[model samples]
Target chain A: MIQAEHLTKRYGFTTAIQDVSFEVRKGEILGFLGPNGAGKTTTMRILAGFFPATEGRAIVAGFDVFEKPLEVKKRVGYMPEHPPLYEEMSVDAYLRFVATIKGVDRDKIDSRLGDVKARCGLAEEGSRLIKHLSKGYKQRVGLAQALIHEPEVLILDEPTIGLDPKQIIEVRELIRGLAGDHTVILSTHILPEVSMTCERVIIINNGKIVVMDTPENLTSQLSGGERIELDIVGPVENLPALLREIPQVKNVSLGEPQNARQPVLVETEGSADVRHLIARKVIESGLDLYRLSTQTMTLEEIFVKLTTEEETQEEETE
Target chain B: MRNYLAIVTKELRTLFVSPIAYVVLAVFFAITGYFFYIILGNVIEFVMQRAFQSQQFGAAPPPFDAPAAVIRGFFGILSTILLFLIPMITMGIFAEEKKRGTIELLFTSPLTHLQLILGKFTALILFLLVMLVPTIVNSILLYLLSEPAPRLVTMLVGYLGAFLLGGALLAVGVFISSLTENQIVAAVLTFGTFLILWVIDATAGTGSTITNETIRYLSILNHYEDFTKGVLDSQHVIFYLSFIFLGLFLTSVSLDSGKWRG
Candidate 1:
């Protein structure tokens, strides 16, 4: 439903986003993951028709964003980073106004209002003033405002930034539930949000797209090899050599000794299950195994590595 | 058109719900009411003196149009008061939206820039009309009680001038409001601009040179004077309309430029 081709935006000397290209299929939940100032918001703004890209083009809901902005705007609902709201107006009045501008049918406005309010968990808070609501409720009202028109595409920039743990879960669930009928492109610096909610993740950094793939693939591809962390309590001077003897064991390194227990990190090639062989080899030796667990690189480590690695490469080139 | 009405309704709701609207309305009514009372008192006293003088000398009192004099004085003061009050009404029209980040919602919506500008302009005009209600009623009451009523056409024309002048100033206020995210700054800038326009003719020397004539013609008050004198000069009407269009056109250009800068 959305296609951005080499879209770049520059504010005088600084480029907010440069040569960014991505496509989001109909009814797909695409997550844009980046640290702050990483052009996630800039890319989303371009797709939503908030501003024309300084170079290139965006096609949203089958309408060119620059040439047919109004038509694209009619089909795309945008929730900005701050949840653009009028604090003085009640929630219902605000949503109705948005619905009207989004070209929602006049006859169906009341029903659409009811539907969006319920969907965003804002049914009871509809009568309350927006400023009077809690932060979580205000966020929900923002979501409700975006959903009121039932647009084909939803562009949300940091949809769950300032919510409690439970509110965050509820919002993630709400976004996840929108996958089949609504194409969503939500940006966030939160790692788990992208893994939990998006079907495809786009990691952007410093005005460039580093990678775009499924969450599971991103972890596995960046990690290079499977890792097993072991805690052994016996004499561990020979543990590295002993673990390396197992077939397909690529390398073994010992961690610092703490309270007479030694932590060992084992690297194995490919996706093979070598834990049982390593356990048998440890038992044959005199070492007593206190803990044996395989660890995949978490999304947090992958994000840091991906974003930081690019900076070092740029520094080296400079 | 639907989008325009939607924006108009939304803006009106925003205006009415905030304390600023009520404060402006109350303050405007109080100040204008006080002036009306004072002007009426002066007019009544002057007419009574004329009557008494005629009775003493047995000569017809100098033709004193009490209602006309009252309207002239009331409208003159009303326009000046509007010069200060209009900035308050329009200062937040776009500034608050930019400050609160709602301008993103507006710019991204399906509505055109002109629709948004016109909607806001219409809302302020409607509120200005509401603000003029008591003044209109006051004049009608004066007409009923006075021995010689004010000329109805002239009175209507003066009110039109007030409306047009308010609208022209409001258009300017809207343009200034769009240039900044600070409401106070917008108000100050709008007031300063209107103040210059109000007294621009004062800069003209006592000469019929083309430069002097242009300066005198540029003063907003110079054109408004014709309406108060019961003359609906098309030139004045065209000038106000063109001024209003220029302000709105500049506002449109400003909005478009923002998109480019962003």
Candidate 2:
């Protein structure tokens, strides 16, 4: 378990992260979603005891990161954004070195080595020098090093970055499989990685936590006032008039579709979906309804809306 | 303790697998071989009465040839050269990790700063011993062909002296390596620092006798000279211990401070 209270990390005059607080429970997978330069990595570093919080405190696995770092370090396994790896070492040697440094039992090193190497997909390349391994393999080796001691808390920053789609999926699956035993906190800019691999998300922007909730709740929060898009093969000018007559419709807008196949861009008001109304109208008018898709406000839309509003507030203050 | 050994093993593994060991050994052997050949050839000719021109020899017709003294002389000078070479060896200690960003992995581990520092120093000392082996072999070769074998204790003292001096320099080098991520800068600063320590004695050479002696004692070279002569003064032991302690202390502080500065 990890809990932080008003964690602030300032670099001279600039505050990289300020007043950030969050808690991750046992066996919970939390995603730190932030844009670049949003202090995501800085917060992770503090949690991992790699950097001291400037004004606040973090307790990781029941040990204060600043005051009792050795115990916290013992309980946590951190894979930094860059995946700290030594190029000259082989995969096996590096993992073994990490295992020993983490104080893994001497007798269990062999079994730990076997278990970790297999789990991290590094078994086949145990003998390969790290420098010679591809980026994906190097990442796997990094994950192996983190898991070598069977640590209870795993903090991985952007674990799936810079990997091919297949490699990304593989890493994601690996991270997903780690949720039951290890309290995992992973940071990334990719939204769906959180949706797919994490149960809860702490969306951080401008060094502050904007929202923290389950994936379902976050999506559902933005679910009201649903938007719909339609492609009707009829008089473009008549589409807006017909849509306005619907009882649930409050407003409609017709514009050039981004794609030639889309034909018409439709904006609807109110939470009620009018896809059925437009469908009936289209057939009655003897016009072809080529495509109809219902759109809900997605996580991407919510993210943009909240973060842009934050920027606008800042601009107004300035 | 296990963590310390783990780090040491890791260092040894790197020393074996990387090109640094080969390159360092090649350059070390090449330089030491040249000096050895000159030292031996001069001694051989001097013994044969072809060229007995050096002032280091005494006029007594002593029973034992001064083979041991000659070996000591060689190691004393070799250690002086090591003041330069060991810095190069330690340049990669912390600097390379900082550069490659692998230091995060080590720093975030459960090990204490003391374990990390001691582990690194142990590896460097072991490597220094490995460097000494070939030179020791060079001495053995000299003994087989020479008329009077070297006084074993005297040669042993010189090698031990060299080891102590090497340890001190290595400590300084590790600290310097931690101050920066650039290896070249670390190597240069490390060498420059020892160079200053190497000459600290001579600055008081013209002053009062007591001042001169104290400064000489302050110089690492002077403390090493006592050991080179085969006397393990408690003073010299303290001096080397202080060197190890100071170096490790400063490195630990430097690393600890990084946690504070954003």
RMSDs, each prediction?
11.2, 12.1
Candidate 1 residue runs with Cα over 4 Å from true position: A224-302, A305-318, B48-61
DockQ of each: 0.62, 0.53
> Which numbered prediction scores highest in TM-score against the true structure?
1
Tell me the lDDT of candidate 2.
0.82
Count of clashes in candidate 1: 0
lDDT of model 1, residue A238: 77
lDDT of 1 at A216: 86
DockQ of 2: 0.53
Candidate 2: tens digits of C-alpha lDDT, residues A1-318: 899999999988889888998899999999998877888999999999888988889999998998999999989989987889878887878887888889888899999999988898877998988999999998888888888888899999989877877888999999999998999999988766789999999988778777799988777655454456677655666766876787765556665654544355454545776778878876777777787776553445657855675466446645
Question: What are the clashing pairs of model 1?
Answer: none
Q: How many residue pairs clash in each candidate?
A: 0, 0
Off by over 4 Å in 2: A220-302, A305-318, B46-69, B144-148, B209-215
Candidate 2, residues B1-262, lDDT tens digits: the string is 8888998998887777778778888888888888888877776666656224333464543443557556766876798679868877899899988888888998899888888889888999999988987788887887676666666677777787888788889999999999999999999999999988989977886766887878877799878877777777888878988998899899999988876663
Docking class of 1: medium
